[model samples]
Target: MISLIKLSEEAFTLYRDQILAIEKASFPSPWGARAFLEEARNPVSYLWALRKGEHILGYICFWMFAGEVHLLNIAIHPQHRRQGLGTALLKKMKSFALSQAIEKIYLEVRPSNVAARRFYTKAGFQERGRRKRYYTDTGEDAIVMSLELLDRSESCAERCGAAGVTFSTSEAQKDLEVSKKRIDLPF
Candidate 1:
């Protein structure tokens, strides 16, 4: 019963508390409501919330730039983890990226977050590289991942690999209006 919807300033106040609650519940060092508010007002940013009826269960944020989208944050409430909410949110993100004409999508996840890594792996994202001491609070390394634009119209799992890599197949592949691109950011 999870649905994805664009988040805007008008609906910011309504979901602020819920978003914060999920952030705190999911992350060791959580972002506050004010931080989320600031990002919502950023022109380069887009936010989406996973909601069940009136309750927000999780959220994703990204920055769009020059035909690419960089995932900023994605968090699901601890109580609702492993219910496919994250996957649904990522699918929505890919749809949005394709719609925006983005050919590359990227994200950074803590190296220790095996579940998230596996989730992304199954969603056609591949590990490309690593950033040393990327998490300032914990001094933890981050694994960079990206998804390449495919000619296929469906989601597909990517082969395991390192970063700064590219995969392309040009055999009469149909262009899809998806909103996700595999991406990586150097830390």
Candidate 2:
């Protein structure tokens, strides 16, 4: 059974190795055990894991504060790339953000990571800015991408083509049916 669930202490304990492996494989310089542990303890940080039965497949972590979400990390296992898992995880993230009154979601990626940059753009994220030498590992410039989850004047449908998806900062859409082609939302 494939499922997406919050990474509880029990799950983290059981799958720490796998999760860490995914991170290491997905990035040039990955977070170590301490970083994951710190995030788990942070009140504003949320980490979610996607699993297939007992095997961990991927995860997403983010910080939510002040009407914004800063996506700290997200990665799908190498073997699972291009299977729509990334899109599903992103949809879940967007839904959760909208419910929490978050107005925007932001993330930074290496400018050289064209694949990730493309994915974010397809998911409705726009290049907001660039940071000089954000990645300490290789001194690579990071491109900031942002997604507006809600607007005061327009519906999400108008901006991203979710059709009936509409919400304000105060009210969140309870249900968002994410369709691959039907929904214009990038991920």
Candidate 3:
């Protein structure tokens, strides 16, 4: 069974090495321990860890500003990739965004990451623009994607068109309840 938890300072202190290990394994240009620590300390950032029992399966970090959410980083452990955990994390984020009245969520992906692009596309994120040579490590162009969250009364399927994004409204509500129990930091 997988569970999501907001990464608190105490949790980070306890799982520092494990989190860094997963990061190094998942990303070509992984954030270092210090970077992760700094992000955890940032007031604008929110970090969440997906776990199976005591084992960390993945993590996501995002920044919320001016009625928008910016996905900073998200990755599932190599062993956990291709499962539904990524989608689950995204649904959780969407639920949280709606609760906070965030209008949109956006992220940049490397053009070389075809799988990520496909995943984002299937999740109803439209590629709106690009950044030339945005990746410092590889000088690769970045694809900018955005998803607009409709009003609660509106169906996501209508706004999403044929993107085929399917998230359970009940699941999102349940996630919201779980989040209320787990999230402790002031936003």
Candidate 4:
């Protein structure tokens, strides 16, 4: 069985090798241990892993602040691609954002990465803009994409009422849900 779990500094340390293996395999300019280590230490940054027992098949790293999410990195092991894992991870993040009343999510993909762009488009993220020379490795331009999670035109009361809960921004900091069957745990 697979589950999603929040990664802590210790978790990152423990899974460094496995995560790094996927990282290096999935990207052209992969992040090294130092980058994950830094995210583990950063207060606003969050890392979530898709785990099957002790092995991490995939993971996502992002930053949340000011009612917005900036997805920094996401990757799945080569063997695990095309199995809906990427979409699952993205959906998990979207749900988390909605739970926190986050308004939008922003991410960047290399213009040359058609697969990623297609995936994001299928997931409801629209092309918003472009950044010049966003990829330092190959000087490739990056296409910015964004997903609007909330209808800000509506009041909090209306939105929260529809969900049968009072609007409370404090819940944004509430822990991720957990269940033994398939839980999202925070360490």
Candidate 5:
């Protein structure tokens, strides 16, 4: 069974090493342990690890800012690739974002990463744009993708309510049922 845990100080050294290994394997210029340590100290960012027993399968870092969550990095250990762990990590992150009142989520992935692109697409992220030569390490472009939470009001109603926004799951469901009735009833 796979489990996801928030990175803690006690796990810092191990998380750093695990993340670095996956980073080095996935990118031409991987962020080292120091960079990760810095990010881990930031209050606006969240870091998590996917683990199986004593082994870490992957890590993700995302920054929440101005009502949006920016996925800074996500890397799965080479040996763990193609196991759907990445999708699970992203789903958990999206749930986190919704719970935090984030209205949108964005990420930049290397354009050359076809597998990653397909995975993101399947996870409801739509390619919105691209940055030319965004990755200086390899002079490769980065594809920007985003998921809009506004369209997922039902999935996010709880957080919206906690934020005092007055959104409710029942209201959303009622709206959906009304819409379905409208469609079925025709003009």
Candidate 6:
């Protein structure tokens, strides 16, 4: 069974090495262990890991500030890709943003990452703009994509409540209703 857990200090301490291994395998330019530790310590940052029992499948890290949410990084284990885990993580982030009254969610992707671009487009993100030589390693430009979280008539909270959407925090694990047979895990 897969579960989603917020990255707390104790959780990070226990899974630091595994998380770093996933990061190294999933990204061409991966964040180092120190970077991950620093991010975990940042007050404005939120990180969550998708796990099956004690084994982590993936993680999403984001920064929340001033009614905006920025997706800093997300990666699935190489062996677990193409199984809809990324989409699940994105939906979880969106739900969290809506619950927190965030206005929009945005992220930067490498222009050459066609698969990621397609995925973001399908997820309702539009290309807002670009940054010149944003990546230091290869001097690659970044494509900025953004998705608005609210509509004119109703707030996301209302919509979510009406839809009977349920999400639990790190402190409340028992509140989540999970299924072992399903390939995708809930947020």
Top candidate (lDDT): 6
TM-score of 6: 0.81
Which prediction has more favorable TM-score, 5 or 6? 6
Which regions in candidate 6 have their CA more than 4 angstroms from the true location? 151-187
Q: Hey, what RMSD does candidate 1 come out at? A: 11.2
- The TM-scores, one per candidate, come to 0.77, 0.79, 0.80, 0.80, 0.76, 0.81
Candidate 3 minimal-lDDT segment of 10 residues: 162-171
Q: Please give the TM-score that candidate 3 achieves against the real structure.
A: 0.80
Which sequence of candidate numbers ranks them by TM-score, best first? 6, 4, 3, 2, 1, 5
Q: Is candidate 1 or candidate 6 better by TM-score?
A: 6
Per-residue C-alpha lDDT of model 2 across residues 25-143, encoded as one tens digit per residue: 99989999788888877889988777665677888899999889999999999998888777767776787677677889999999889999999999889999999999988999999
In order, the Cα lDDT scores of the candidates are: 0.71, 0.74, 0.74, 0.76, 0.70, 0.77
Model 3 C-alpha lDDT per residue in residues 1-187, reported as the tens digit of each score = 5567767665665567888888898778989877877877898898887766567787889999889999988888888788777776787777678768898999999988898889889878999999999999999899999999874664543332222222221112322322324332122
Candidate 3's error at 164, in angstroms? 21
List ranges where model 3 is wrong by over 4 Å. 151-187
Which residue window of length 10 is worst by lDDT in model 6?
A: 178-187
In angstroms, give how far residue 1 of model 6 lies from its true place.
Answer: 1.5
* Model 6, span 1-187: residue lDDT tens: 5666777665676678889999998777999877877877899999888877678788999999999999999998989888877777887788778767788999999998898899899878999999999999999999999999875355544333322223333532343422233222221
Q: Give the Cα-based TM-score of candidate 2 against the true structure.
A: 0.79
| Model 4, position 33: C-alpha lDDT score | 92
Deviating ranges (above 4 Å) for candidate 2: 151-187
Between prediction 2 and prediction 6, which has the larger TM-score? Answer: 6
lDDT at position 80, candidate 3: 76
| Model 6 residue 49 lDDT score | 81
How many residue pairs clash in model 6? 0
Model 1 bad stretches (over 4 Å): 155-187
